[model samples]
Target: MQGHGYAPPPPKRPSTGALVVLRVIFVAVPILSIGFLAWVAPLRAAIVTHRRADWWIFGGSLVVLGISFAYLSTDHTDDFSSPNGNVGMIILLLNAAACVGHYLYADIRHYHRLYPMVYLPPQAPAANYVYPQPPSPYAATHPQTPVTPPAPAPHTPAPHTPVPPPPQRPAPARIDQVRAELDELSDYLRKRDGHYDGGRDGR
Candidate 1:
């Protein structure tokens, strides 16, 4: 007679607490970073003239928080571990990377936009300068000519042209030499006395 086999139990669901914590972290890290950036700007202005450190600190903290949240979100089950759990972790890491990247981009853009403005010397306004009156139609029609014709100047030799750079040569292969050196080393090592005498020496 054929015997019936017992069926396996259903998979266990994740704890509500773990899910709640994971969701909270997912939403909080970005929001916190934005808030920190906003708060630090004014504090930096009051404390330190240069606030690069503040921005960096805020960005780094957000990244750390994101990573911590991602780790906390990782849940492994005995019977049925969610394949998509790692996806959430990857997305969190990606978000952290994006935050850091955006911070760097903004910092760089800010410096680029401000650098020229800061370094450029202010221009002086022209003072006591009278605008030239437009020439009359008669004067414009008949232009004055020079009395004596100017002599042709002597020509000078052209400046030397730069020579083109030589093409780069490929580096020589040292693999053979390295192999020979390794073989020599192996030979030296093989020649050394063995500590264990072929399992013959008694301790």
Candidate 2:
């Protein structure tokens, strides 16, 4: 049984078809760069990977090769017009062109396959669409169109309500006592002012 702290080791790097293709190209760089990209010419995937400097190197090699082929193809004036030399010269020039053209466009996809960090499938571009911009309050679009006033909501007629008069309070049972207290207050006021007004005056 495995221990509780035991953790499985990380997975090893995966083998890709691109890595296999690169191996084939490297091997054939001597005799003939053949394989899927070579024999299947006209239609080919990137076979060999190249660094930025590799392009210049390939270009220089092509120039040197072209010059060499041209020199060999030239007549020494001894057989300048012979059919045999002419055919060989044509063949050399054609081969040089083909080599240059093939190397010029060799596959650029390599690091992705060789290194684990760089091999991600190409992300498809996000679908593009002009989303309707939210309307801005500062810029009103329909200033000319008059806004019709909303019709006043119909007013419901209030029902006629007869408010009953407040209930009549029962006559006070202490009316007599209240009147006696009032007469006493009136007499005390009259004595203080030295002006007496008999009850008969208001009666």
Candidate 3:
């Protein structure tokens, strides 16, 4: 007799080292930027004065540098592919580009926040600063007269008619009388058939 064979178990999932590194970079960059904003007032002020493009470049550089550091620090064997030193360097370069973009955006936002008002373009003056007047007189001068309402008419009396009362029913006769009639009828029927029994007489 042949024996049954066992099925193979499922394969294990790969390590999440790369994903962990990516998440760390994502969270760390923003947190660091916020910290810098809070602690370094001079930097923040400088950012406000700088052109929008400059701020984008600054922010983008910081993010890219941070990501590059994360990539470089991760262990090679912990990931699926062998770690390439050149790959880490390339990521750093890409990060620099991203920094430039971020700086530009930040600079523009800072400028707007610090300086809300913008200069308006000049134009030729008109004949009059105020608009031409209309011929219509003031409404308060021609007040509407109040009108009084008419008095209501007197009410008329309704006709008087009597309504007939409903008929009253008499109370039912005694229950004993009804029972006695029933017993008499039953006795007569039983006697007619010659099967009458005295056992039901008391009931």
Which lDDT values do the candidates have, in the order given?
0.54, 0.52, 0.54
Rank candidates, TM-score, best first: 3, 1, 2
For the record, the alpha-carbon RMSD of candidate 3 to the native fold, in angstroms, is 27.3
- Candidate 1: C-alpha RMSD after superposition: 41.1
Where model 3 places Cα greater than 4 Å from the true spot, the runs are: 1-88, 97-101, 111-146, 154-161, 168-203
Rate residue 45 of model 1 by lDDT.
Answer: 27
Best by TM-score: 3
How well is each residue in 1-203 modelled by candidate 2, as lDDT tens digits?
96699689865654668656654554354235322122222123332443554455455544544554465465565654566446545554454445435543453234445454756798866676566898776667545667899999999999999999999865676787788899999999878665435544566
TM-score of 3: 0.26
Identify the runs in model 1 with alpha carbons over 4 angstroms from their true place.
1-71, 77-84, 117-203
**Which whole-number lDDT from 0 to 100 does residue 66 have in model 3?**
67
- Select the stronger candidate by TM-score from 1 and 3: 3
The alpha-carbon deviation from the true structure for residue 112 of candidate 1, after best TM-score superposition, in angstroms, is 1.0
- For every candidate structure, what is the RMSD over all alpha carbons to the true structure, in angstroms? 41.1, 27.2, 27.3
- TM-score for candidate 1, please give it: 0.24
Poorest stretch of ten by lDDT in candidate 1: 40-49
